[model samples]
Target: MPKMKSHSGTKKRFRRTGTGKLMRGKAFKSHILTKKSTKRKRGFRQETVISNADKRVVSTRLAGR
Candidate 1:
């Protein structure tokens, strides 16, 4: 069989932790910051853990990374 390929978009957006959980960036901090409260904006700045339901999809796309 040919080598499996990593999903380019997933590779760019997600990473696997040492323990195997997928790490992802929190949403909504990318734009329109002026309307959101400072606290809320700060919360979005933090890295987030990908949900369990989505982890399998990410792992498959990442080729078991």
Candidate 2:
């Protein structure tokens, strides 16, 4: 059987943690920085784990990652 092609965009935007959870960057920090507070911007710097409900779909595209 041929190898499956992982989603290129997903591969770049998300990653699987050592524990197998889907890790992705937080949103709302990329624009309008002047209106956002320092604390809020700091929070966006950290990666967030994907919610359980969305795990199945993400896992499929990230298979073999």
Candidate 3:
């Protein structure tokens, strides 16, 4: 059987923690930041965990053993 390749985009954007949780960047911080409040920007700067609903998909993409 052929080896399954991990999703390149997912690999770059998501990380697997020691406990197996997926770490990802918070959304809405990539553009139009000037209009957002300083507090909102600060909030977005924090790292976010992938929701349980999305964790499975991310784990599949990551292809961790």
Candidate 4:
């Protein structure tokens, strides 16, 4: 059987942590930085775990990893 392919976009956007939880980047940090507060921008630098609602879908997409 052929190998299953990973979702390229999901692979780039999500990552597995040491304990296996999925981590993802914060949105809204990629544009219009001039209007955003420094604290808000700083907050975006941290990675967040995927929500329980989306965790299953994301894990399937990331399965090939």
Each prediction's number of clashing residue pairs: 0, 0, 0, 0
Better of 1 and 2 by TM-score: 2
Backbone clashes in model 3, listed as residue pairs: none
Clashing pairs in 4: none
TM-score each candidate: 0.88, 0.89, 0.87, 0.91
For residues 1-65, could you state the per-residue lDDT of candidate 4 as single tens digits? 78888899999999999899999999999988999999999999999998999999999888964
The global C-alpha lDDT for each of the candidates, from Candidate 1 onward, is 0.86, 0.88, 0.88, 0.94
Please provide, for model 2 over 1-65, each residue's C-alpha lDDT reduced to its tens digit, 9 standing for 90 to 100.
78888988889989987888799999898889999999989999999998899898889888844
Give the Cα error of residue 40 in candidate 1, in Å. Answer: 0.8
Which is the better candidate, 2 or 4, if ranked by lDDT?
Answer: 4
Local lDDT at 50 for model 4: 87
Lowest summed lDDT across 10 adjacent residues in model 3 is found at: 56-65
Off by over 4 Å in 4: none
- Which candidate model has the greater lDDT, 1 or 3? 3
Candidate 2: residue 7 Cα off by (Å): 0.6
Model 3 TM-score is 0.87
> Which portions of model 1 miss their true places by more than 4 Å?
none
